[model samples]
Target: MGERMFPLERQKKILELLMIKKVLKLTELTEELNISIDTLRRDLNHLTKQGKIEKIYGGVKLVESKFGESTIADRLISHIEEKERIAKKCSEYIHDGDCIYLDSGSTTFQIAKYIKNKKNLTVITNSVPIVNELMNDDVELIIIGGKVRQNEQSVVAYEYLFNFNELNILKAFIGASGITIEKGISDYNLEEAITRKNMIELSKEVYVAADSTKFDKDVTIGIAPLDKIDYIITDGNIKKDFINKFKKITTSLIISE
Candidate 1:
């Protein structure tokens, strides 16, 4: 039998376990925690009431967070200032004649506005908004061919696997729906996650540009682990604890003002 724990402690433990496993059968959870069925039920009810978990017929799974489901337009207006700060700081790493991959996201779209002045730069992207932003600029622009996802204003790069294989990206700037020490970086959409993964693998340097709100969250599909990221750029609003935690993972954590 597992040692008895307070209600809050047990509930916290249950949530932690759910975070890792995503879904857990009632018997499995009870056996793993050595808790009574009634106790587990109470915890499950509390979590369900909080909209944190969904109770299935015989198991429970975490509720999908709304951040990942939001459209690009929705995201664009939500964290305008924070996104701009992070994007401005991210743009500092770019230079003339560099081949960079910008993953499709609202933050990366903000990067397009800042990089219009760079000469001889090659910008490759799957974002329709980013393409529109940089099309008339004096830089070479390449769009990854794919099915356009209207909500995201981005391409699902499944049609251009060959092009991705041959490209040598100098630096890749990516955005995430969530970031966690355990999950590294993740997004809700599997196709987007796969696209980001390919970009990370092909790039010499990988930078994740996200606001402080992205930290300590997890989503359905994982893009890459912390070991794969070279830098994390975020706004100054990030907590000191997150700074300390991420410093140990990536080469640099740039906190933008």
Candidate 2:
């Protein structure tokens, strides 16, 4: 038989479960984890001591999560269905004659794939993948000039910052590594964070599209707070607690089917 999961892996799963259910009883956790009560007790005790969870009457709840940035391939593969749902929901906001900015995110790239047929739509992006998908489409594509950040399949630089001032964008669709009520929007890269802040300033409206997995999490760099977002489109499977929290932060909270 294969080796069993490590304590660290089990603890991570516990935190992820908390993010989904908001709360879980010890019994449910034992069943899901396939571990005995005594072993799970050790894991829970460790996580609680780390300040990662709050031990309630019968189970545990997640404190906010701190996540590291993943490679583009990792991000694209982890939650494909949820990302697609969020993308489809965000795509409904696109219209002909509108100039929009698409952040270089896998989810935002999905939006590009969905909107290929929209004639006269101006798409400004720094993402290599997004540009490759839309260059031959009916939409107007503007690729920002910057050093390519190959891991993200995007570019980041300040040399072309003035270009944004010359154009009027109707909307900006931003993606983030983590989003918390306290942190608003954030990512792991300093340069990417700078670019997102500029996009926020240049656009008349901002829409953030992220999956449920991104909720209640914070990363290394801060982008902006709730006040900057006009709308947030996410998958419907998100926890009710997250839904309520996001609703209070953004002007409109759309749950995608």
Candidate 3:
């Protein structure tokens, strides 16, 4: 949910601009930064509290400060090798101009880690963290409008499902709290579950990016039935029995090192 929201580089760009311009208007920042107003507001808030910048009503200016960055930096460091491998392998299906949906969860965010630089891709997501990951990329982004959840660092529910039927999503990369032949795919939050369900329904193909630990576990909220999944991309350490079961449900699967 961290850089998977807005990368460290983009945040640095804002600070760099303030260093040069001293005081930059919101319009200038938005225009030059190429990030949405709402997203910039959140970044500015973070920088303000970090004592790196002073937030004015319509703009911000850099401030000399020594506060260390917290909360997000180390997050991208966890499950490092596994997530990176899974992310790279799962990303093979994403073509140059594919329109896709990326779900919330650190694992799915890993998918963004690999494809943020892919040109002409259209990524539709409700995860605030995912937006952070791709904000500076050369791609079209569509953030699903909804209330942002602070802990999860994602947006969900509300009117987000309205025009999904009109979007021709080529593929959906989802994160699962649990994946079993019995309960299907699930997440810990009902709101997130519903949101992921919405994305699965909108896309032509659905792929779950899960680590080995989530294979047999079942969480609180259900996302979709087993058969809805088209591919399962995960670490090769998964149990053979679990892989056998998954084969019966999904059309294809990939186990990456």
Candidate 4:
């Protein structure tokens, strides 16, 4: 027979349960694992140290979770300052007259806010809000036509691909469902991944704008490999160890303060 697991394995099991479900009370973990209260506390501490979950009054929940099926408004509040800081840093990379593609995500939307005053820039995107943000600006906006995804406030369909195919973009600011050295880049939906992949292929440089929470979570579709990425712009709360891991995978990693 195989060797029995230690307390750490038991704690990992608890986390697995939390990931698949929504929330779990301390009593549930202790009762199911048959562990003492003190041992359970130690397990929770271990997982917390690893940035797996947050400890609550009687239970633990995933640290980077959309709790209680949180709406987009709720998520926008979670990392507002960090995203604005990242937007400022990304703004430094854009120059006058650059042809850029902006992807649909909270962080990238913040970048759109920063680009409003910019002049003579050409923006190509399938994000409805982004197109509207630049509509009255001195810049030229080429909105890729596609079927709209209302929840995401963006479009992802074959017509969008047709728009992308004919254009030569200077840079692409996009997001991923997950970023890992192993899987590279992934998205939760296949249709979204298709549009993202086309943008990556069309752009000379691809910059991924993600908050710290998007670091380890794996979604369902594969978009691109690490070899295709030029930079990653994220927040300060990301552990130094994880940032270093990505540095070894890509050349430049900009982590905002």
Could you say which candidate leads in TM-score?
A: 1
In candidate 4, how many clashes are counted? 0
Candidates 2 and 3 compared: the better one by lDDT is: 2
Model 2: lDDT to the true structure: 0.82
Q: Compute the lDDT for candidate 4.
A: 0.77
User: Deviation in angstroms for 121 in model 1?
Assistant: 0.4
> 75-119 in candidate 3: lDDT tens per residue?
344466787798899888898989999886777777887887677
Q: What is the lDDT of residue 46 in candidate 2?
A: 97
lDDT of 4 by residue, 1-257 (tens): 00145977787678656643447898888777777778888888998999878888888887764543343333444578888898778888888889998887767777887887777889888776676666778878887777888656678857634655679899999877688778777877677788899899989999998888777777788899888999988888887888778657653789877
Q: List the residue pairs that clash in candidate 2.
A: none
Task: List ranges where model 2 is wrong by over 4 Å.
Answer: 1-68, 160-162
Question: RMSDs, each prediction?
Answer: 16.9, 12.3, 9.9, 15.5
Per-model C-alpha lDDT, please?
A: 0.85, 0.82, 0.77, 0.77
> Considering summed lDDT, which 10 consecutive residues are worst modelled in model 4?
67-76
What's model 4's lDDT at 225? Answer: 84
lDDT of 2 by residue, 1-257 (tens): 00189898888778656643567999999989898899899999999899878888987876643455665644655688899889998989998788999998878878987898787899999887787678788888888887888668788957545466886989999998788888788888999888899999989999999987788889788999978888888897778987677655545778899
Q: After superposition, how far is residue 15 of candidate 1 from its true place, in Å?
A: 41
Q: Ranking under TM-score, best-scoring first?
A: 1, 2, 3, 4
Runs in model 3 deviating more than 4 A are 1-77, 160-162
Q: What is candidate 1's lDDT per residue for 136-238, written digit by digit as tens?
A: 8898988888888976878888744547878878999999989888879999898888789989999999999999899889988888988899999989888
